[model samples]
Target chain A: MQKEKPYKVKLSIMPFWSPLTPPMGIACLKSYLEQNGYSVRTKDYNAISSLFDFGGRYIALMKSYTPVDRMGNIAMVGYDVLMAHLIAYNNRDDFSLNDYHELVRQLILNNFFYEATDEAIENLCELVEQFYALLAEYLINDIKEKDFDVYGISCYSLTLGPSIFAFKFVKKYFPEVKTVMGGGIFADQFNSNSLELETFARKATYIDYFLLGEGEIILLNLLESNFKNVPRIIVSDKTVKKVCLDDIPLPDFSDFDMNSYPQLVAYSSRSCPFQCGFCSETVQWGKYRNKREEKVVFELRSLTKKYGKNIIVLTDSLLNPNIDKLADALLEVPPEERFYWDTYLRVCDMAEDMEKVKKWRKAGLYRVRLGIESGSQHVLDLMDKRITIEKIKSNLQNLADAGLKISTFWVVGFPGETKEDFHETLDLLREIKDNLYEVDPHPFYFYPSGQVDSESWEKIYGYESIYEDKYNEMLMCTYYKLNCQPCREEIYRRLELFRERCEECNIPNPYSLIDIYHADKRWKKLHKAAVPMLNDLIHSGSAIVDEYRDSIVLR
Target chain B: MEMERKGIIEVLAAIFPNQTIDIGDDDSFIDKLGMDSISFVSYVIGIESKFDIEVPDEYSLPSKLDTLNKTYDLLGRERG
Candidate 1:
């Protein structure tokens, strides 16, 4: 008998985060492989209960081993609870510091029972180690029957540590499995000539290939030839130029369970119009290119039909300029059968098109997260934001009037941001408080390849401050006077004042506004006092949310 | 007592008006009535000032609505 044609080589793709279940890139590759007569399977490691079990146990172990004796009980518990409270509060200004303190107290007294127990710590560590081993076993055993050729892992900034460890463990057990890593974080951080990148590539021997940019075509090519001298592939001591976006196949999310993820992920278009000072998109994709209108509508129709009026989140650089096309496509959707959708858009675009706003609402758009950047005209111009305060206010009001929840992102402390500028931002928040469902304030982050840099940043701000490790490549500047040495107390004072003003105004406090600075100064103090208790509370709340999904908005 | 009940009722009504909301002395928030997590959180915050109870960590707020009513009962017990 003729030997059966080797079963189509099976390919598995896994995401490190749960809400990351919609593996669009992986899906695109899967469809391509299937079309080419290869078997494809995708898994979201984030949804695996075993990961959470490991995480909880690991958290428990860390809490138990927390050197309470050296730190003193008051400081230790206090710091842990404080850190946890900050994480739990997570950009909500509705609650007071008193509220956070009280919640931390209760959490320490109740939920943090494991932290005080040595037996619990031991058990948790054992469970974590065992769970990870078993997880490796399950993954390896699952693929053992299929005779898989390669495994692809999607890595993001938050999921980097977990995905790296998982990839290494999987490789150790199944040495034959060629592991490939790719994603936004992997591409941004490792796809360069940095000492850090070199170290990572050298250390992680298991990760055979790091497919930069879009992985679908490159991955397919690699698998077809069985990874023998592939083009656009990065291995030890080799670099490749960025791949063209058009060359990659459209993402297929059908195989993965998208419902398990929060945020309905979709991309109407890629590439950005404006090259903002701080954006990585400009560096990654090199300017804006709108996807073909017909292709976009076709994908939307397919997703809507399959997902049953799922919330369609456009992971686009800007969706406003294409309002006419989007509106026409949405008109095809029934009013009652409408799906909730959200996207980022330029304030200037929205201000110009009130009719577009109205159409979007009718099309069942629930939320629009606008990058207002700053309240000060000077700051806006300096950042090359090119949008005015009046435009922001008008567009925000228009969106809110159209019955859509508006979340505005404000970045404070850009280089050259004066005391007046910060106040202007606060004033703007106060002015627009009634119209906004939420307002998030993020501090200026310095990343690689931004308009702000050490030389330019110092010239603008007249300060010599070392950038954080995470933001070494970008230039970040904040307006807080306390940021200057010997006056950091003033920074705390201003932050507290900002928080108080937000509370008084009933506006939601942005995530990391106060905590980011505070952590910078006394991370150890805060981490020990409040982090543990707060984490317990957030996890507990998340658990309740998960258990009672039908009762809550759930997302 | 009447004023407090009215205040609580008004807040709950503002959040969920059309739905029939039953407040019982012995009923649990999550188990007996099934208030869910987000609603239960809002409920907790809305009543924080009224009850003179401080919940420092919103995360550690009881997962079970049953546990929440017990806290309410405890507050009542202290008052009584």
Candidate 2:
């Protein structure tokens, strides 16, 4: 047997993706290919996008630690608008920019993007067009500068439209380059019909191969087969070539300019263990998998040494799954050599284990992010969250007492969440306000195929998935309306109340600037006057953040 | 200076309602007035809009505009 000649492979990620950290998807592919003796080059076109003036401001809002409530909705609208344009571009039909503005206005009228003003919507439409043109120019110029056998684009939730847009440029200008599209987004099933899959399939002429599931094994197989006799749609799960978590080589970040990013990223695990009904992690990744604890620690140390970064952000869905073995391994690293890291964790009895929690802090777990979700135990049980309110409160205190900065997420409108249940959530926030470092309150969304027992739960919750008129077909996820108390408007009212409660309690919201600005703008429109409620919210939330920052300065 | 100070107070009052923000010209925002970072930024934007001026990017920080006198001076420079 002879070693196959390595293909000149180049993988890239497009804009609307965050530049705060190097993407783990392409890094994994580059390492898998290079280890198998292939030449690989990777580029962070997102970092390049951030270099543009408007792009800088757009991405700064993303980087401002804003929660997904309004900001995420705005990003969703942008993604949809770009997708509409891409469809027209692929069909060689003219897409009127004003049509997109009207589409957004209709979305606004249809109870979506309610946070955006008409003026903001207009600017967002123009910005999306400008960014698409600029990114296309940058991508084409880079393709001209290099020659590669395969060009891969890693698409995520926000990057799908832009990713395909970039691939169109490559297919048009560099036809010889075998264009491949792959990412976790492909594995995500947002609706019952999988509209995104169908939409992309229509334009599949621009893409040579669409790799589903994990890319490492499928990519290796494609390269070994010399890109011949391969199916246009390669599903990793269906194929026999599957990758085990432990066997894959460490992700190579050398291709990325590590200095441009604030934190270095690595994952100790893939997928998540819990099956929360509202979450889509288990849907995208069928089951949970973890690397050996020693392997994880070794990778963290290697990344810190190689990149000279002191802050590491573990991209794991939940570190609690392997926190015991992983934290113990990390403790073995001498304190002086230990790098600070943070990750998402589940609230369970393990958090109450003061000894283990303190050991995690000693092991340099800088911040702990928890999906507290709700305060009503009934609502929590409804979501299959499995953790009790008593346990949640005690666990929050234990983690805070162990000197961990706790950032929490609260979902305002779960299916069965009553007004009393919402107040319970507010009460829970007030109870743990002293311990919380950041508060992120989000409105609930239903994805038919993205969650566990989604269909059955939809029946149980008595809600139907309607394709929200003509404009919503371009949306990545399905639109749903609850047919009970606390309808959409009620949910938004509660969401506003939730934000006001956090401000009233003086718990720092990371997105207070954007939140207050939008609130002030909306208030002026509705009431025709400047109000003190906005100021009160800001003044209260600001005190906590100012004090928090001042303590950091003192430390 | 007095007119500017009076106008600044009116703007601050509108921005930070429900509070009695008593301060001398030399009083510090953080220590004397308890103005948090968010309040400070809001105040700057408020004063800029009220005065029809734009503060330089460098002087928008709370530390640079800690005192009403300091804010007044910065506005004078920007207005010049």
Candidate 3:
């Protein structure tokens, strides 16, 4: 552990999916530590914590005196087109909140933050302490002008609470720079719980080393050799290595500004060729490898022509692991410079390809997502998902008739699942709620690497541990003292009274263009006092995402 | 091009992944592998889905299919 010369190593990657992309496991560990030499640098302070928590939640939702006569100037130009595509991509061309969501309504942009108060999570915890005093003034100016040693961050369990609020101000103002942590939520909650590595060794005791799983040859053997021969170099060891997927590299993202982002992410399969036992996505990337879909269409055409962008976003947990070699490599691209991706497949990989999902939808494979966690094949065979509830209703009608765009990732309590398998998953969401374009429901989230703390899920249902659920105060959620056939709080109170009986049977929520105006009881009590300043512009985006980080990270 | 010759051998086994791409018939298709302008529109979307045939935007064309008999007589005159 010694570094003096020009060994400069920085890496950063903090704030939530950094305004949408560029921290792909710290740009493949800064291209495998600059092809095994060293000198690496990356910051993406969640792209400046998504331009100051989306430009301070659109200046706290244009001073919300919410009368919405023209829905508050279309919810303040959909928060300035989602904060000018989360700040001028500086990586490419922009303008988004999905292009003024063709004039606002995914429930007026989900009622522009409909449920976020406790004074909008204390004004998103004061814009997450001014986004951790702007990552403690960029790690105290890279520890006084990059006289670097080592400092990786990458954590992803809702950016591990903004990498423990920037590893407690980089040990209170660059305490002799040397921290490190690795991604996929400290490689699936470090060695699956000893109370999550004794609460991450007492909140990452200024993390000297924790590079657990596939962190490129334990971050090129803890930054180019030293520290007693590396391999799973966790200082206080947990041991996990993984690299040779045909010698990993090709991911530089040249220290990022990849035209900022909102697309362009690669991975044509890593760990997910179906390990679905209420997946903790193969805890620390182990099996299911795929890459060569012609090297994922030549790294999506040389990283979308060096990030000019052509909409990719693959981050493969299971992107068609050989849908006829992903429709013979998206039918050899070039259908108008093909590459429009958007992955995640398994509803049994679009139920055995409807003619190679119509040549992977003319090789751009538009949006797919679908974990369809359960429509009850006895709770998808207690989540082992050997699939069959008629291949999750004929693979969501063959990926919406192979035109794609379907979105879903359902899960509603799974212990021994029953109220007749939650009324056959609300009769398979009221029989494919019109070929569902988006649903995203969740309830059962008790992970220590989900297989619900196995002993074969406690020798056929018994779990025993119930009551932990803290969720904030550095996470704590254990739950499961069941021992029976249906009890995750009576299946999370019949899935919150089955989402108020799918908004009293209007059943919409494919991300809200209409839940028939919140299935009104007088426009849901006059749009809940007409958006009380859209809950301080939706929990000031909880100073850049951490709340149940959408229920336990993995995927 | 008997079976439009295995869809140009699955677009040269998807642009040479784990190689051994044996294309011949006077190999040129824009000087063989450097056909930029996006791999010549992915080699005309592998010759319009390998002769599922649509190649006509008023046919008559051949600055170079350079040869498998000019990429099978430009797909038999864009399949007539």
Residue A35, model 3, lDDT? 72
RMSD of 2: 11.2
**Reference-based TM-score, model 2:** 0.74
List runs of model 3 lying over 4 Å from the truth.
A1-23, A26-28, A31-37, A40-210, A213-225, A228-251, A254-263, A266-305, A312-372, A375-404, A410-413, A433-555, B1-50, B53-80
Q: Write the per-residue lDDT of candidate 3 for residues A1-555, one digit (tens) a residue.
A: 234334667777654443445667777877777776677777776554223243435333433423333232222233333322222121121334233222222222232323333443334334444555666666676556645667778776545555655665666666766777777764443444436555556645677777655677766666555544553335212344456665676777776665434456778667775666666666666676676667767777888766656666787787655655766666666644544667777766545666656556555565678787777787777676776878778877766655455667777777777787788877778777656655656666444443434447656554554322221121322223446645544654565555654555454443211111122222223222121121121222213221221122221
Q: Superposing every Cα of model 3 onto the true structure, what RMSD results?
A: 25.4
Query: After superposing the true interface residues, what Cα RMSD does each candidate give?
Result: 9.0, 10.4, 22.8
When superposed on Cα atoms, how far off is each prediction in RMSD? 13.0, 11.2, 25.4
The ten-residue window of minimal lDDT in model 3 chain A covers A528-537
Ranking by DockQ: 1, 2, 3
Q: Chain B TM-score of model 2, please? A: 0.87
Ranking the candidates on lDDT from highest down gives 2, 3, 1
Give a tens-digit lDDT track for model 1, residues A180-244: 88766543435443344555666567788776555555665676676676643453222334334
Residue A445: error of model 2 in Å?
Answer: 2.2
* Model 1 error, position A102 (Å): 28
Per-residue error (Å), model 1, residue B58: 2.4
TM-score of chain B, candidates 1 onward in order? 0.54, 0.87, 0.27
Please give the DockQ score of every candidate, comma-separated: 0.07, 0.06, 0.01
